[model samples]
Target chain A: MTRKIPQIICALFGMTLFLLYFSQHPTARNLNLTILNDYFQIIFAFTLLVGVVSFVKVNLKAFERGEDRSYHLVSVIGVFIMPLLAIIWGIKGDSPFMWVFENIQVPMQATVFALLAFFVASASFRGFRARSVQATILLAAALIMLLSRSTIGDMIADQIPQIADWIRNYPSMAARRAILIGIGLGSLTTSLRVMVGIERTWLGGDK
Target chain B: MDAGTVIAGILTLAILTFLYRDNPVYKLAESLLIGVSIGYFLVINWSNTIMDLMFVPLFTQGKLMLIIPLILGLLMFGRFNRKTTVLSRIPIAVLIGSGAGVAIPAMLDARTLQQMSATVTPILAPDGLPNISELVVMAGVITTLIYFYFSREHRGWWGKSATMGTYFLMIFFGTTFAYTVMSRMSTFIGRMEFLLSDFLKLTQ
Candidate 1:
C-alpha cells in the first residue's frame, strides 16, 4: 500500500491536469491556476528546505570527521547567518540580507562563472585540433565566431561578421530545431510513461 | 570604497585565487558562496512562498483549503524517517505527475509543431529566383532530422546524409562554445574593471 498510494495519486493528478488542459471552462482554469501557482510554490518551498537540511547535515558530518574543518565551519555559519540577518531586518533593498546578496554573493558568483573563460580558452587551445573533416569544420566555425567577436576579425576581413551570422542563422539554427523536436518528442513520451505508471523511478525505487 | 564594496572586493580576490591553485582562501570563499547562496534562497523562498502563499492565506485570509498542501509539504520531512519515507513520495508524486501532465501538450505545441511549421517556408523568392538560403536551411533541417533517426541502419545515402548532419551539429557546437567563451570573457573583463577602478582605484 505504501508505493501503491503514491502511484495512485500520481496517475490521478497526472490525468486530471492533462485533461484540464483541453478544457476552457472557468472552473477548470481556476483549478489549474490554484494547483500550479499556490500549491506548487508551497510544496516546492518545503522541498528546498529539505535540500538545505541535507546540505548542512552532510557538511556537518564532514566537519565532525575533521575534513576541511574551517571551510565547513565557514559554510555552516554562512548558511545560518543570512537567514538570521533576514529575520532581524526585513528583506528590503537597504537591508543587510540584500546587501550581502548584491555585494558578496553576486560578485563571487559572477567571478566563478567568469573564471571558466580562462580554463575554457586553455582547454580549447589544447584540444581543438582539426584532425578530420568534421573537426576542421568545427574548428573553422569556432575560429570564425571567436574572431568575429574581437577587433582582429575586422582587421582581417570586412565579411567575417556576415559569414559568422550566416553560419549561426541557418546551419546552426537547423541543428537547434532538430534537437528541439527530438527533445519535445522525448518529453512527450516520458511524460506519458510517467502518467501511465511505467516510469516509477521517481518513487525512489526501481519497483 | 564603501564597506560592502571593500568586503566584496576581498571576497572576489579570495575566489580569484583559485586560478593559482586551490588554497585556504579560495576554499573558504567557495564554501561561503555555496552556503550563503543556499541560505539566501532559503530566506527568499520562505518569505516569497511559505509566508505569502501558505501562512498568510491559511491564517489571515482563512483559506482552509490550503491545509491540504500545508499538510502535504510537512509530509516531505517524513523522508528523514525510515518508516514514514513512503509518505514523502505522495507530495513528490504530485509534483512530478503535474509537471509531466503540463509538459505533454506544451512541448507538442511550442517545441515540435511550431518548429516544424517554421521550417516550411517559401521555396522561391518574389523575383522567381531559387532562394539559396531557404534551400540550404531545408537541406540542413532534413539531414539533421535524419541523423537522429537511429531505428534504421545508416548505409548508402543515409550514411552520407548523417555525415552532413554531423558537420552541421559540429558547427552548432563550435559556435556555441565560442559564444559561451565570449560571454564569460566579457564577465571576466567586468570583474577586472571592478578590481582596477572600483577596488584598487588604479587608473588604466
Candidate 2:
C-alpha cells in the first residue's frame, strides 16, 4: 500500500503540475511555482543532513577497517563540528562559518582556478597547431582575441578593439544563435517525449 | 603583510606548487577540496534556499501543516538503506512531475514559436540594404535544415546548398570553441591574480 499509494500520488501530481504549467489559468501557475519553490527549499535543508551523515558513515567504516591514513578523521571531525557550531550559534559577520567559508572555500576555489591558467597555456599550445585551413582560422581568431584584450597588443596597434568588436558582434553572435536554435529544437523534442511518458529515464531505471 | 594574507599566501603557494609536480602538497589540497565542497554545498543550500523559502514562508503563514513537504523531502534519505530505497520514489516522482510541469509551456514558447518566428523574420526590410544578413541567415537555416532531412537525396541545387551550409556550420562551431577558450582563460587569469595579489601580496 505504501509503495502503490506514493506512485499513484506521484503520477497524479506530475499530471496536474504538467497541466498547470501549460494552462492559461493564473491560479494554477501561482500554485505550481509556489509548490516548486517550497520543494527546492526542502531539498536544500535535507542535503546538509545527508552530507554529514554520509561523511560520518564513511569515516567510521574507515576507522573500523584500521585504514592507515585514518588521520583523515581530523577532517571528518572538523567538518561536523564547524557546521554544527555555525548552525547552532548562527554565523554572523566574522563568525566561524563565515570565516571558514571566506578563508577556506574561496581561497581553495581560487587556487584551483589558478591552476587552470597553466591548462589554458598548455591546451592552446597543443590544440591550436595550424594543421589545416580550419585550424589556421581558429588560431587566428584566438590570437586576435588574446591580443585585443591585452595592453601589449594595443601598444603595438590601436585597431585591436575594432577587430575584436567585429569578430564578437557578427561572427560570434551568428554562431551562438545557430547553436542556441539547435539546442532549442533538441530540448523541445525531449520535453515532448517526457510529457508522453516515452522518456521514462527520469522516472528512474527501466522497469 | 598581515597575518591573514601570509596564511592565504602559504595556501596559494601550496596549491600552485601542483603545476611543477604532483606531490603530497597537491594531494592534500586536492583531498581537502572534496570535503570542503561537500560542506559548502550543504551550508549554502540551507542558508540560501531552506531558511528563506521553506522555513520563513511556513512560519509567517502559520501553516504548521507545511511539514508534509518536509517529511516528503526526508523520504529521499531512504536511498541510504538498500532495503527501503523504494520509499525514495515518492519524493523523486513529485520532483519529476513538478519539473516537467514547470518546463513544458516555457519550453514550447522559448524554443519553438519564438525561435521559428526569429528565423522567419522579414528578409528584405524596406529601408535596410536588402537585409543581406537576414538573407544569409535564412539561407543558412533553410539549407542546414535540409542537410538534416533524411527522407531524400540532396542533389543538384540542394547538394550545393548543403555544401555551403556545411561551411556555415563549421565557421559557427569554430567561433564557439574560440569564445569558450577565451572565457576559460579569463577565469584562469582571475585566479592567478588572487594567488599573486590578494593571497601572496607579492604583486599590487
Q: Highest TM-score: which candidate?
A: 1
lDDT of 1 by residue, A33-68 (tens): 999889988999999999999899989999999998
Error of 2 at A37 (Å): 1.8
Model 1 lDDT, full chain set: 0.91
lDDT accuracy of residue B155 in candidate 2: 88
Q: Per-residue lDDT for B58 in model 2? A: 81
Candidate 1 lDDT tens digits, B91-184:
9999998888888998999999999898889989999999888777778878988899999888899989988998888889899989999999
> C-alpha displacement of B104 in model 2, angstroms?
2.4
Docking verdict class for candidate 1? high
Interface RMSD, model 2, angstroms: 3.2
In model 2, which regions exceed 4 Å deviation? A1-11, A24-26, A44-52, A59-78, A152-160, A203-207, B125-128, B140-204
lDDT of 2 by residue, B54-92 (tens): 687688977675677788778878879877777777776
